[model samples]
Target: MASNVVVDQDSCISCGLCVNNLPNVFRFDDSGKAECFDPSGATEEMIQSDAIDICPVACIHWQ
Candidate 1:
């Protein structure tokens, strides 16, 4: 199954956890907020789940 991940920039604290956890799927924008650069890059569900779980501000979510 394909996953739809989204980061709420307003709620994101720029912790970089998601990027560190899944660089292929998440990245930091010019403003330093987390953004989904390539949702399709997340091939494994576990990695996606880990990203969501590791988000301190709970800004990452599935759309």
Candidate 2:
């Protein structure tokens, strides 16, 4: 199944953890907030889960 990934902009700290680790799935917008640019960019659930887990601000979510 495809994961519906999302990044809570308000809760993001602009840490770049997600962007640096998973550049295809996450990125920084003009505001510097973490954004889920492409949910399907991650080929495995574990990768997506790792991104969510590594987010210091807990802004990344899979719905």
Candidate 3:
């Protein structure tokens, strides 16, 4: 499946929750916001549980 994960930098608090939990799929950009570097890096289930669900700011989502 194609990668559909995305992050709202404007809403992100840069808490590192997503990156810490799913490093392969999420990471901090140069501006210090959480961004999806590789949506296909992890399984959809893992991304949903680890990044989307665990995000304190709820900035991550499907695109």
Identify the leading candidate in terms of lDDT: 3
> In candidate 3, what are the lDDT values of residues 1-63, reduced to their tens digit?
585988989999988888998889888989999889899988999999998998888888898
Whole-structure CA lDDT of model 2:
0.81
Q: How accurate locally is residue 17 in candidate 2, as Cα lDDT from 0 to 100? A: 83
Candidate 2, residues 15-53, lDDT tens digits: the string is: 888888888888899998988888887766655566888
Off by over 4 Å in 1: none
State residue 12's C-alpha deviation in candidate 1, in Å.
0.4
Can you tell me which runs of candidate 2 are displaced by over 4 Å?
none
- Judging by TM-score, tell me the better candidate of 1 and 3: 3
Tell me the tens digit of each residue's lDDT in model 1 across 1-63.
Answer: 676888999999998888987888888999999899888876657555768877888888888
Task: Summing lDDT over every window of 10 consecutive residues in candidate 3, give the lowest-scoring window.
Answer: 1-10
Clash count, one per candidate:
0, 0, 0
Output the number of the TM-score-best candidate: 3
Ranking by TM-score: 3, 1, 2
* Residue pairs of candidate 1 with colliding backbone atoms: none
Candidate order by lDDT, decreasing, is: 3, 1, 2
